[model samples]
Target: MNDQTKTQAQARNDWWKGGVIYQIYPRSFQDSDGDGIGDLNGITRRLDYIASLGVDAIWISPFFTSPMKDFGYDVSDYCDIDPMFGTLGDFDAMLAKAHRLGLKVMIDLVLSHTSDEHPWFQESRASRDNPKSEWYVWSDPKPDGTPPNNWLSIFGGPAWQWDARRQQYYLHNFLVAQPDLNFHCEEVQDALLDVARFWLDRGVDGFRLDTINFYVHDKELRSNPALPLEERNDRTAPQVNPYNHQNHLYSKSQPENIAFLERLRALTDEYEGRTMLGEVGESQRGLEILGEYTRGEHRVHMCYAFEFLENRRAIASWVVETFEKLGEVAPDGWACWAFSNHDVRRHATRWDLSDAANRAYVMLMMAMRGSACLYQGEELGLHEADVPYEALQDPYGKEFWPEFKGRDGCRTPMVWQAQDEFAGFTTSDSPWLPISPAQAEWAVDRLEEDPGSLLHHYRRAVALRHDHPALARGDQDGLTCDGELLTFTRTDGEEEIFCAFNLGDTAAHMTLPEGSWTPLAGVMSDLEAGVMDLPGWGYVIAKREGE
Candidate 1:
């Protein structure tokens, strides 16, 4: 490539830094052939709309060959596209189209486990004499023929399943159909590397490693101790589930995971500017794990935790403290932030909000110092729809009915047009989850014509961040925990911008830092009076004195 071409490539490839990524859940995004499931061609047809949103990239959830027990999380063939999604050729066409539109593509990779029917697992379980027999964790049950240890699965019950063929208990941290792989085996690592190389060779920009921390377990099979109620971290599972009862010492978050991550990073490093973002799900040490996973020059590029995603109305003090803790623990690490995804309730619905609160939360998320990830329909200020019990498909929701409805509400199909049948998503078949008339009214086609819509606000907010150096790629400082108001400043040398949020129900006062400043964005509440009158949830963005 020539000098100018190389420079352009560098800029285009450097899209992950401070870039906004739009996540597409393949099952609910779009259905091209109307098989009642979203497919590769469907994603290809929607690339233009994704680019129009001004997102720097697209993060697609798994579409690999699977049994769909966990809806594609349980992979049967890592190297082939599932017939439900389309063929391998279709994926390549989608990648080519996305690159043409200047959008990076990242695919979800579930390395922690595989479907029981996967060829590797099938062969491994056939007999202990097979070459791939050690690829999965198999151990003798206790004398009473019970699970070896006390590790609990996030899906409920113990994390061990008995294999009649092997006459031994195998570890499965999720559904019984999905068995955990033995990261202790070198061949297992090599096999997974080959799977990753298959995609890299196919021209994918990066990967989002699902349950990255769960790749290994404590070899000693130690039992995890109970967590005190006051000491419990509330971000792991639903409040109604007992999965949060333990400290999680044995099942996952093993130190051995770092070496495997380093290996994956080395693979990505072969292709210049390629990236990897791991999903760290530990409740107590999630941010710390994020730091460890992304720390140093040889590890993954970034990682995300459930901190902000779990807490809907996160306090101003909590935000400041969490970032501060991240800096102190893992300074070299990068973070990817999001408020909603296929796995959780939408933040707009989780946090009961009025007009001001809704607007402020969006600004706060965009302003945070990191790469941002926006879920589909978030730009339209969409809230989660209440799914009837009969319509719920999420296993978690089915298991924990009335009290804890599953994630089906947030996984509804995207709405494209206000008046079109099925919201212009698909014409021939019904969506996996029903669409809300309220949500359909906020469709992209309708919002595109209205200048004052939430879509416009999102575009402007993202543009402002892109234009301001202080807001993008800047050092964070001046964080103060003042009563209900949390204030902080982001700076890049000569430029600085102050940000404050009123994370409470009543008004609070905040004194400006020694000099005159200009209001930047999300100027919802008034700033004239010495005592700032912040009504409930309010936010302010101000630039420092002078230039």
Candidate 2:
């Protein structure tokens, strides 16, 4: 290996590149104090379990001080830990334990906005002439007493909230309690950067930036144009959500966001092994923004859009088209792909996948060109929990009601023991959200005893990716789709591997590409000669004999 080759190898081994990241929704993971809510101490106790999954890192959802209006996303204090989640000492302990187990910790950072109860927001809304008054986006109402512009909130209704204290309207892209910060103000930008520095100094490995594209809004406060019915897709928001009616041109994904990202990247670069994984939430232009945000070194290291999570059925054609689009628009950029997370419906139930399909999807995600994220219960093949209407907590779901249930179903507690009344998640009878019967059946203890369980399959699949350099950090090529079958190739210098998937239930036959190959174990599939016959939801990962 020469100097250039050594440099390429080091880049490939960088933790964020094609590495597996497990997402832990803090409030639902485990409850150490038995208060029916997961806390920092609980996560500290489970560090070994997380590390056993063969993931390179863990991305924990928000556990910051907040009023819980939107859970921890509406942060009231950026530097402090919420009492419900334990103290700063508890967080440090968790961080130490995670590092000891060789798992990097990436925390969720909600920098685009802050809770209304935050001191800065309280001071900003106090009086328009105050020094911090411009810290948040505030504007005078229209002459007719309507909002300053036609922007709409993601939680339904107009995006502007009339504040009697300042006699002006404030902007909130999500819930009214979560007010958008004035990134246009250099002071606000500097303060946010300081927040990032605080966490970095505290030993955090990296950050998962929430709503990264919404960092900067249109300075002119222009109204967003109406989206044509034909162009509107239910990818970012639910079909019942009125937020999909507009194109959102002036509201988010603004050009100015790039400069702020460069500044943020520069800050992260100050520390070794630090990275940023941004979440882009646009419906039509997600890939384009992803490419722009991560195009160069001085920007977010990687990004993931709503495409895979929103697709009810990740058909072969859909997967092929998505990657093809990425290759065209973001050839130089990187992406962190995920099938489920804290905010959406779990893929197992959302897609109505069979046992085979579930296994196949996991294999496909691991074999993809970039990094991957696995939600907490995905390894056990847990579906979305059934949260009763009366027990719902998500404001988004509560507002939509029977028409479209909110995300509480997916945010339910993880079932650790099948026989425990609380599924071993907590000793308390009452959890934040009930553990559904379906999830209980796939409990960790139960899956651990079953060798053929989805849990073991996930473990082996993840390990296989790590063992094969071509699958983990190689460049993807030759993507093609034939009816319900999808095929692709990955190569890293002298090593080459072929991957094929049958996304349907019935057996499918296809002619394999010309190559002297050897089948790799762990992935489910059957191949004979040049003809490949795969059962429904079957897949194969093979290495070329001599490439």
Which digits, one per residue and each the tens of the lDDT, describe model 1 over residues 201-238?
88999999999999999988999999889877558787
Q: Best candidate per lDDT, number?
A: 2
Query: Which ranges in model 2 have alpha carbons more than 4 Å from their true place?
Result: 1-13, 522-528
- Kindly list the per-residue Cα lDDT of model 2 for residues 487-542, writing each as its tens digit: 99998889888888999988888776786677885343444476767778888888
Candidate lDDT (C-alpha), each? 0.84, 0.91
Worst 10 residues of 1 by lDDT: 522-531
Pairs that collide, model 2: 397-406
Which residues of candidate 1, in runs, are more than 4 Å off?
Answer: 1-14, 504-507, 524-538
In candidate 1, the residue pairs with backbone N, CA or C atoms under 3 Å apart (3 or more residues apart, or in different chains) clash, namely none
TM-score of each: 0.94, 0.97
- Judging by TM-score against the true structure, name the best candidate: 2
Q: What is the lDDT of residue 401 in candidate 1?
A: 85
